[model samples]
Target: MNLNLRAAILHNVSDNDQSQLEDTIVDAIQSGEEKMLPGLGVLFEVIWKNSSEDEKKEMLETLEKGVKG
Candidate 1:
């Protein structure tokens, strides 16, 4: 939706230890397990706390669109 919410989601999604978190998200979407989306917020927070500015911006844009619609 808005930039702040998008940034938040990106922050959570980027927190996962696994490099495949993005893939996992895609799989979840394909499987229709939409409930798992909330966990992305946690991952986003983790990532947001530790990420570089460039990475944060990219992820923010991507997750914002994903979460918003």
Candidate 2:
């Protein structure tokens, strides 16, 4: 996960307007594509990096519920 590569991927996602990226994410999750999980990890990493501690705590709580459900 090079920062430069991650930035490039994020830039590409942003430039493409995220619709396709959303679809890909949905497909990956629904299809249980384990490999695609890393992409999600990257996304979470980006968000977590920029988020406040409270936001991160809330996100983690939400994720825990999602995982349980």
Candidate 3:
């Protein structure tokens, strides 16, 4: 069976409102389950694609700090 994980993840969360999306993210993070990493990666991919250069820089900076911290 061929599975398109990115598509499946997007389809599941595409209709979520801001609050629901927040809940989904928080729940996924708090769960610390390996399966959730792909979902978060898909979400970050969408965010990175839509973000401006400045936003991407800020995200990189934050990620760097997070890694160091």
Candidate 4:
């Protein structure tokens, strides 16, 4: 059985509305499970890929601050 984690994650969440997506992310984080990291990463990848340059820079800044703070 070849399980593609990224594909699976994307497929599951792709149809979700904004509120559903936010809930998924919130639940994943609040659960504090290491297994959820890859799913979150996949979500971030989609968001990053679709973002504009300004959005990416803002995200980077937010990430940097998050890492520091």
- What TM-score goes with each of the models? 0.42, 0.62, 0.97, 0.94
Query: Which of candidates 1 and 4 is the stronger one according to TM-score?
Result: 4
Cα TM-score of candidate 2: 0.62
Alpha-carbon error at 25 in model 3, in Å?
Answer: 0.6
Candidate 4 per-residue lDDT over residues 1-69, each given as its tens digit? 999999999899989999999999999999999999999999999999999999999999999999999
- TM-score ranking of the models: 3, 4, 2, 1
Instruction: Estimate candidate 1's RMSD in Å.
Output: 8.9
After superposition on all CA atoms, how large is the RMSD of candidate 3?
0.5
How many clashing pairs does model 3 include?
A: 0
Evaluate model 4: give its lDDT: 0.96
Between prediction 2 and prediction 3, which has the larger TM-score? 3
Q: Model 2 Cα displacement at 17 (Å)?
A: 2.0
Candidate number that wins on TM-score, 3 or 4: 3
Per-candidate Cα RMSD to the true structure, in Å, reads 8.9, 3.5, 0.5, 0.8
Ranked by lDDT from best down, the candidates are 3, 4, 2, 1
Instruction: Write down the lDDT of every candidate, Cα atoms only.
Output: 0.71, 0.77, 0.96, 0.96
Residue 4 of model 2 has an lDDT of 75
TM-score of candidate 4 against the unseen true structure = 0.94
Task: Write out the backbone clash pairs for model 2.
Answer: none
User: What lDDT is obtained when candidate 1 is compared to the true structure?
Assistant: 0.71
| Residue range 1-69, candidate 2, lDDT tens digits | 346756655775675446887786787789897777777777778779999999999998998999999
